[model samples]
Target: MTVDIENLIDGESKFVSFSEKISLPDAYSVNGDVLVKLSGKISNEKKGLFHFSGNIVAVLNLNCDLCLKPFNFKLDFPVNELFSRSIHKKDDCLSFSGNIINLEPVILDNILVNMPMKAVCSNNCKGLCEICGHNLNESDCRCEKEHINPKFEKLKALFEESENE
Candidate 1:
């Protein structure tokens, strides 16, 4: 959705409320849709700079990094940004030239930044067994598991002997 900044600037409106249902494209692999809510107030911070500050709330569907299980992640945070008719190299802000502002990227970027680097269902997730590539959380393996490195057998024997003593 696009916010018509030019219209807002020229009018007497001081604040704006926006809500949108955003779904990622099939090629962009996030699990589910996002509901983004933004309420911002427009202010003239400097001579002509339009500063917008607001709150953004979103629910993102993410997956467990290790087990690849889907889960819902909630994001509620503040957004402080500047929208300008031209680019400002030194200032930290988003550029908008025309009447339209494509807020999708801004909303998406904010949500993504809050995403966990390593998402897990829980701390106790058993995860997949390294030896047989079996999902330990789902089931157990009955077949005797071999050591990843054959040389570890001697060390295993030593450890067993120590435990016996």
Candidate 2:
């Protein structure tokens, strides 16, 4: 929701309330989803100063980084911030004034900052077999020989040459 500065010029306080479903398209590096229930309160305190606080709850459906399987997760976050009319000239932080505040960017930033960098299906996720692309968590593949690094072969050859010399 957008807050108009004109309505807040006189130090009058108001609330920006929402209980709608919001979507996070790029929830993960590959494919992931987050549906949030958002509700918040915002108030104008003084000239160029505002207070924003709220609660957000989300259900996340994402692929496990190791197992490559879908996992359901939950996230709960409390939102609180201050927007001042005077900008800090030397800092990267933002300044707000003239009674206008657009909340979409703020919400998005909070969500992205709090998201998990890596999520696994379980603590002991077996992950996929590198040799055959088989999910080791479910079943094992008969391919015993694993892929070896070409760099290792070169090192081995160097060691043999040194031994012969």
Candidate 3:
């Protein structure tokens, strides 16, 4: 959703609340769509700068990286930003013009940053077996495994000889 920033241009501090429901496009490769709620206030600071701060809440459905199972997760983050007349960096500060503020990129970037790198369906997931690629968490497989490296067998024999001695 496109947010209009013209109202914030006025020389008055106002409370503006907006809620947006967006679906992750196919490009994102997300398992399911998510609902995002954003509400905040915009105020004009000294000079032609504006400040937008608020809270963003969202729920996402993603697949566990380990188990490949789907799970729902919640995200709650606070939004804080400073705008100035021109984009400049002095010491440690951000500035933007008061006439126009594009919030789409900011919102999207924040949400993406908060996403978990490794999502899990449960705390303990057995995951898949290496032998036959079977989902061990679902069921047990009886496939006989073979060890190709003969050096490993020699090491096992050494351990067995030591135990016997």
Best by TM-score: 1
> Candidate 3 — worst ten consecutive residues by lDDT sum?
89-98
TM-score: model 1 vs. ground truth? 0.67
lDDT winner among the candidates?
A: 2
Instruction: Evaluate all candidate structures by whole-model CA lDDT and list the values in order.
Output: 0.69, 0.71, 0.70
Q: What is the lDDT of candidate 3?
A: 0.70
Q: lDDT, candidate 1, residue 134?
A: 78
| Winner by TM-score between candidate 3 and candidate 2 | 3
Which is better, 1 or 2, measured by lDDT? Answer: 2
Among residues 3 or more apart in sequence or in different chains, the pairs in candidate 1 whose N, CA or C atoms overlap within 3 Å are: none
lDDT (10s digit) by residue, model 1, range 5-30: 55454434467688878886442337
Task: Using lDDT, rank the candidates from best to worst.
Answer: 2, 3, 1
What's model 2's lDDT at 148?
A: 66
Predicted candidate 2 versus true structure: per-residue lDDT over 99-138, tens digit per residue: 5776766767787777788888888999988778899999
State the TM-score for model 3.
Answer: 0.66
